[model samples]
Target: MEFYSFNKENGKQITKFNSNFVMSRIIQTDEAAHIGCMYLDKNGLVGYHQAVVPQLLLVLNGEGHVRGENDEYVRVQSGDAVFWAKGEWHETKSETGLTAIVIESDGLNPSAFMKLK
Candidate 1:
């Protein structure tokens, strides 16, 4: 329904659309998959949340950190891509502004944004 736009909710920094926080429309309901791009500003944090479908984090620029439901974190830099499973609580933290592409697709994949329950 809604397209991509700036996101500042979740205790995170402002996320730009298309250039930063851009997500594709959901193709499947039962599967709950979505694809999009994202950016994280310095000291930005996206509070814990779930995904509608499986998420693939592709680093486009800058550096940052991602926190999972397990409280585990992974260091990320440009040209790096990470996979975040759907239905799993996760959060993103950035020290400096970061730009990345997020792909949410596949029937087996669901975005935490949709399935927050």
Candidate 2:
């Protein structure tokens, strides 16, 4: 069992993200799972990117908008969750600031599940 807190201030910042956004990696495992937090200050934006693995983003505070491959943007707020499939291109931005949790798992696949006989 593991116990941890998602303290924004304690996390290490990821320099790979766009200057308009802040990303912190909280946890990464050999099992191909990783967890992180993203913060977008007012008027901040994350440029277009593609997901190499399945990812889920859960809003923890504030609000933002996300755009997918279709180029359609959708509003998101605290408590909302968004899913991005592998290879999907997406981006995010906030006019009023936003905080979110990001979870990614490259090893999690439907084929890994087995049915009991």
Candidate 3:
């Protein structure tokens, strides 16, 4: 699988709302959304499974490996974002540990802002 990365370092600095931070655009869903924080410890894993809806995993801390239908793992670290369409098979694992934000909805369209790596 190919890599997909989106870090705040690549985002625009916010001068309109505030001047102290950079904002990385993740997703904008018009439908109802389910957002949650996920933590994977050393040797942790989120087993291969089909996505119930359009899902976006935004890495917030540490690093990990992720795979889609091909079963090939792609390295991901802080600022990386992975998207899986509804019914797509995917898995995530980390040798060390990682923390991330997961956003799931039917209207997710990450390509609007995030570039594939």
Output the number of the lDDT-best candidate: 3
Q: Please, what are the lDDT tens digits per residue for candidate 1 over residues 46-94? A: 7878876666665678888787777767777765555566576777779
Q: Model 3, residue 50: displacement in angstroms? A: 0.3
Candidate 3 residues lying further than 4 Å off, grouped into runs, are 1-3
Candidate 3 local lDDT, 1-117, one digit each (tens): 234567866677888855777777777878999999999999999999999998999999999999999967888999888888899999999999999999899998888877776
Backbone Cα, N, C clashes tallied per candidate: 18, 0, 0
Worst lDDT window (10 residues) for model 2? 108-117
Off by over 4 Å in 1: 1-33, 107-117
Task: Give, for candidate 1, the lowest lDDT window spanning 10 residues.
Answer: 1-10
Candidate 2, position 52, lDDT: 81
Task: Name the weakest run of 10 consecutive residues (lDDT summed) in model 3.
Answer: 1-10
What C-alpha lDDT values do all the predictions have?
0.59, 0.67, 0.87
Each candidate structure's TM-score, on Cα atoms with residue i matched to residue i, is: 0.58, 0.64, 0.91
Q: Residue 66 in candidate 1 has what lDDT? A: 80
